[model samples]
Target: LRSTTVRNLDGVFELMAQATKGTRDAAAEEGAHVLAEMSPKLGSAVERQIGRLEADVEHLLDEVFDAQIFEGVAALKSHDNYTFEHSVDVAFYGVMLGRKLALGNEYLKDLALGCLLHDIGKMYVDERVLNKPGKLTASEFRQVMRHTVLGFQLVRQMPINSPRPAHVALQHHEQQGGGGYPNHLTGTNLLARTPRERFDTSRMMLLSELTAVADVCSALSSDRPHRAALPATEVLTVLRQMAGGHLNRQAVEAFVSMVEVFPVGVHVRFNGGKYAGSYGVVVKCTPGAANRPVVRLLFDAQGAPVPEGVEIDLRKLPDDGELTAVPEEGVSVEEYAHRLAIARH
Candidate 1:
């Protein structure tokens, strides 16, 4: 079964490479394509877990890590299907956080698979409810919340080496406090909720905690049926607020450090008349100083094109000269190129 799955995936990768020929980073493009493919493959694997398909799942994870998945995550900015894209994004984030913690290759593979399938139960959900543009009623929301348990059931059937994936499906929604849904279990209670009775509860597995962080970040940063996507900065702020009590503090901190406050390619505005009416595009983010990224000024204070793009490293600026705000809507590369062309003419 493992060999057959690998052969199938190899063919998929070749097709993806050919399909994304025009992309600047073909490996990244292939990563996104692989993610998209996994969405359906996961559902199939869950249906036939006794077939020992976990090896194939791990193989895909290996490819994702090797492809430098962040580029694929960036490529997702143009994709419209939030459901499939969100799973891939969470997997990318989970793998990144796993690497940052220096987890072994085996653990990283499990983490990637766990994050990718965390929301797989949502496949059973009603598409109208999932895609509705209005608020969900209490009943509808309850139905939606069942995905955790449903996902757990599916993953539990798989003959995987680690039980962490199934645990993640069930407990990713469970919080540090007893406030989370389904079971509202916390501390010892949370650990006890695992499928197996004998697993250690000394500390929640970092995989489960990290999956929660990735899940929250991916969901909040995405456009939902009920609301527009929140800014990454705002989502991180929300995560910080949830840390310690609702989320694992160390996991949250690790996630923040991995993604930074202002990720690359986001559009931001300088506060206090520094770039008053203008906007800047984040080009690079410093590891420790997330807020102080390197940006290319796209317009002047009066909203005219800068003609010559002016790049700034916020870390080099005085404390008082740092950017104050990032608008809810970010500018895209195409939009920036269009503006730059107008400025040039």
Candidate 2:
């Protein structure tokens, strides 16, 4: 409920994590009950839960786009909670991206609501296929893809007046050049435009385009049963690669500008340089230079933990590639918490 900008983001992140967990739990319960009873009267609970978190979402926007915090927060997800957690994260990312695109307050409200329930229809999917840890067969993938239409149908049944949220659920998966599913809807073409022009003209992409970018970013950056989360740097690269083809280019471009690639509290390793093989945690991100953060080295080249980490400003370094995201195996939520405790003490 705190709206102040936080200097120590760890505590703020913990609060936001609790909010997302609560929202996720409530949505999951409501979605399941609605699915089983078939009377479809649980929309109010989902809406109420999301409404309560609007302040928290605004707080999240004030802080860093810490992918590591989300990685740790989303670790709270079990197989059953995946969709709910994903929905909240998408809402967070979507609203953040929407603000970057200058989509005013009214549009942002709709975007947040749309992103929150964008995957509600997944409650109707087969649990086995939804949580399958292995590659899905073509037919299984097809079944999984039906969540879009199913989600649209489910959202339309809700009491909301605007159809924008329902359309978001339906068209989030749709791609440019007409290659997407459920409906082969083609989005606005930004390929011929400049970044400024794209930004000026991006509102036509609307709620669905914003949600699509957010959805892809959250899915790729978070752990899946099939694979571990990609590194933030790699996620940035993937977002760029998918921009014009699978996602809204204007949204993706705006997202890349705002995302914290080496977010605070993330474990990192020196890819090369004098500190090669040394491990560290990102302690700060210089605004507008997310890829270059201030690091506090926590482990030596021999993998021994340092009692007191030495801080290094990445921007002060001569080379940009001196530091890189640590491999997924190298990061531990405990280690991150421990480092924060040390800093706080």
Candidate 3:
């Protein structure tokens, strides 16, 4: 990541804050509106809005070296709707990874736009099936799967200069091998599903591959109608397991590097009683050392607040003695303080 990219990402956070004006509902409703306008024709107003979003994302990529901006966006992930928040999250993650991959500004813009609208076709999906809390019947599942094709059709009508958004909408769900759905396109077969002018038979385009990674990440980190959100560590582990067979390995790796396994600000406890049952907040994540981060120790083994917190860099530990394990859901500040006060007596 470059310094300029980091600066741009900082700007993106400010832009996103301004876009929503401090309301998650407003942000979600704005995204919902965009998805609603996708039918029949894309219209000039929608196209311009998409363009503005693209430009904002491009600014985010212009300074990709900063982790603070990524952490800032991560802090805002507690949104209400899976539909709207998922789109914005995917766009943010996609652009972050794209910048890490050193993609040009124009390509980043297109990738961000594609990710933001990848699920626009889901607007046509049956609400009952989309919002169902239980396992879907086979027929219901099929209706859900149709969103990809529907999304492709809707995005194709947009006046955007590139066809990448439509292509991504069609191919994001397709796996690396011949196993994925709707079209089940594998290898050369996948090429036929996207526009021939923008894609080649030699390989899957990076835009689709990047968007797929972002889609999976955002969905896994979100609370869906069917399941609770998975932790970031678990999500990355699942993505790594799918690499080479179901996902693009390079894209997955880039995502892992950009977001890290632990991510900053998540509360965690050392495994095996390494810190005497103390809980800590992750302050910085070292790339490649996914499990080890610089943590600010806040609670002691006796369940007492540390008062002046201690910062520990887990990466410095010897390989044999490296800290292990993070709680599925990390300790909350309030929970920690309350528990500590009770134990002190």
Candidate 4:
């Protein structure tokens, strides 16, 4: 039934899919109402269960991150403009990334909040500007920056219990460079006083970073108000090159692993596996290798995408052909792990 609820709610996502320059506010308000209705029906136990599941998800990521040291990116399949839809996706992704970073409880809570309200600023932007088909003029862009201020003002007005997200609402666009608007503040200057140890920002900033990564990755990887998403591998490459100076290195690394560049539930084109090794998600296995790495023989392992089906575990070299040793040169193990998690989701 809970799964049914999620499915039904996901169905509602289509209603707001055509959203553009004029329907943002209505979409936000409708989304708010929809969430209000769904939260209660989900029940306290389900809520707690979801919460614990989130924790477990975080735990798994923490171990993965500790072992490899990376931030974690999201692998969203949709890109509708509904604020609630995008916000929830970002929050889920943020929490997942927070777990990977081994963030503390309070910070994790803030990260969750940050993920929720990181886009509160969008509420203030005109529907036209928010959904413009093309680039905006300098002045129009400046008006967009006002969303952060407007978001902070709106949150201050509300008697909402949480302030952590409100802060993210205010600082989400404040870039690493002092060039960011509102207060020409640079680097940490644009950040908020968070539950962080050093560069803390209610933990949301980090999630905001994750959100930003996911938001852009999803946008660039999917159809948007102005254009269609780009190639998945191209998206990864761009992020890789933009690391350090423009984006966070740790965050980028996690994101690459998160998407499981070697996507799950789908067959992979290995570097060199028998029949070139076309395999599906190994739901029963861990990150290393799918317990029964399903395969649907079609393509060779030369990085070429081919139509493959779910079949047998190719990891166990065939009895007919004696194998020398386990093959190496293919998909990254980290990608395999993240894909497994995504498949289970």
Question: Rank by lDDT, descending?
Answer: 3, 2, 1, 4
Q: Candidate 4's residue-wise lDDT over 120-177, tens digit each?
A: 5565457788889899998778767766665554433333345655566666655455
- Model 4: lDDT of residue 111: 65
Which residue pairs come into collision in candidate 2?
Answer: none
For residue 139, model 4's alpha carbon misses the true position, in angstroms, by 1.6
In model 4, the worst 10-residue window by lDDT is 319-328
Give all TM-scores, in the order shown.
0.63, 0.62, 0.67, 0.54
For 105-126, candidate 1 gives per-residue lDDT tens digits of 8888778768766775564456
Q: What is the lDDT of residue 324 in candidate 1?
A: 41
Candidate 2, 1-345: lDDT as tens digits? 222212122232233334234343343434423333344454455444444555555555544245444322221111323445677668777877776666766677677767876776565457898889999999778767877766676566555656778788887888876788777877664534456544542233467878988888788777888888776677778888998878877777877766767767778888887778888888888655666679887776776666565788878886735567765577574675586577667
Misplaced by over 4 Å in model 2 are 1-81, 189-204, 264-284, 294-319, 327-345
Range of the 10 consecutive residues with the lowest summed lDDT in candidate 3: 23-32
Q: How many residue pairs collide in each prediction?
A: 0, 0, 9, 12
The prediction achieving the highest TM-score against the true structure is 3
Better of 1 and 2 by lDDT: 2
Off by over 4 Å in 1: 1-79, 123-128, 187-204, 260-267, 272-284, 288-290, 296-312, 316-345
lDDT of 3 at 129: 81
TM-score of 4: 0.54
